[model samples]
Target: MSSHHLVAVDWGTSSLRGALLDADGRVREEQSHPRGILSVKPGGFTEVFETLFGDWMRPLGTRCLISGMAGSKQGWVEAPYCPCPAGLSEVRAKVLEIEPGRISIVPGLNDSHDGVPDVMRGEEVQIFGAMALTGLRDGLFVLPGTHNKWARVKNGMVTGFRTFMTGELYSLLSQHSILARTLDTSAPLDEAAFLQGVTQSDNGQGLLHNAFGARTLALFDRMPTRELASYLSGILIGEELRTQSVHAAVDVVLIGSPALTQRYQLALQAAGTQARTLGAEATWAGLHAIHSTSHRKT
Candidate 1:
């Protein structure tokens, strides 16, 4: 009736999102579930999908398109990752059909280069979508999330990318580590403390040592106990920037939520790098791109 209305889902470790797309690939309606692939019981991906959109979309046909952790080994069905230096066509060709072409999951990308050997599941969509939205044919993209990603594109092809577990480390240390006792998670972020942490990250004291200063500040009455969270945020983000110092020399486009992107922008400014932000819609654009590309071949 609506020309495919096929559901496009981005299932991650902690969240799941589905958007019903019209013929033109515009999102007609959207739905979200806090229960992610990890939170569900074994073999519950289909069930979760059913509970989320089974009824409303059942009559429209369940043939769907999906991406993200839904394709990981822990997800619905492991869609093997495509190699790097890949374009949208290569990525489109690798889509895994979960129900004999009824439901499909997009594979992530693998950068088999030297060093840390990077991989990205859902961020690829955002990267390509950002390119389409911002008219950036080729450049670097900073997709900030639990595991912030730095992806490179050349001539409209995703060459490679790396990962930084900035948000994960921040949450772990601030919640369960020694810094948790004195930190108030609810307190608003203190910009001065955060900036101070970023400023001091270059002292050559090392991250493990810098972390201790969070407690040292609290114990010595050096700063407000509540500001430790923001301070630690700056330290972790600043360290991430240091690790990706290469990007500091170039203009990086950040794609993520406004709050996280704003913080990254601040750190980037401190590092003397130029940056900008794209919103959550970039993923939808990327997904629609894949869908249209796939249909053209069919």
Candidate 2:
């Protein structure tokens, strides 16, 4: 049997994160790199890993468990997705071994709701980690990012979920679209303007019409020139919460960076909803949990 530690990875589209864990599953060291799946040359994943962790693993070769885009088709290896309402055991059973059971990739979750398929990778681990850490039996869990995810969880398992491209759209419209010219990108959010957008989402006017309001608001000087971006962002996030929160329990679990979560918490509050923010390092906790239970030979 090997005495090496476990290395947990959260390799997403734009970044790669590695954590070296001791036997007790506590992270002893952590490393992050910008070499995401999209940036790595085709079939060069091995080289990239060596560049990032070779020296760290030199002391004692570590068994690795990877999640996120690293398991997608575009990633190092395509670990097949497990169908939802899935638990960790099911996800674990499908973990793909990249090196004779030594290096493994965690499988993402897939759901077909109303014939529309959706999936999430790294978030699965974080969501389950929050579940294990908080001991919450059921609620709505949100992971805010480029593609915001809203998941329905029950009894420590993910029942179903949906994804929204609100962040991506904001970037596109704020940076490259015509609206980009009318607003200051670096301007801080105007809470009043943002809340106004949140309020507008419920006016029965649909997103299409309301999105246009970003332009109209600035055109008419209805909102401050510097605050246009914030108001726009609010509109998108506000609408996302409005539509999805209805399917959620009274209290929603909001996850992600503090800045983003705070915005969500406020939006949630405005929507007459309650949210509990989990400040733990969810992905690491999740990977640690999986590694603890796997107990596979190195």
Range of the 10 consecutive residues with the lowest summed lDDT in candidate 2: 242-251
Per-model TM-score versus the true fold: 0.93, 0.93
User: Which candidate should be chosen as best, given lDDT against the real structure?
Assistant: 1
Q: Residue 245's C-alpha lDDT in candidate 2?
A: 40
- Tens-place lDDT digits, model 1, residues 158-215: 8988888989999999899989999987888788888899887878888999988999
Native-referenced Cα lDDT, model 1: 0.84
For candidate 1, the 10 contiguous residues with the lowest summed lDDT are 54-63
Runs off by more than 4 Å, candidate 2: 1-4, 59-61, 245-249, 296-298
Residue 111 of model 1, lDDT score: 91
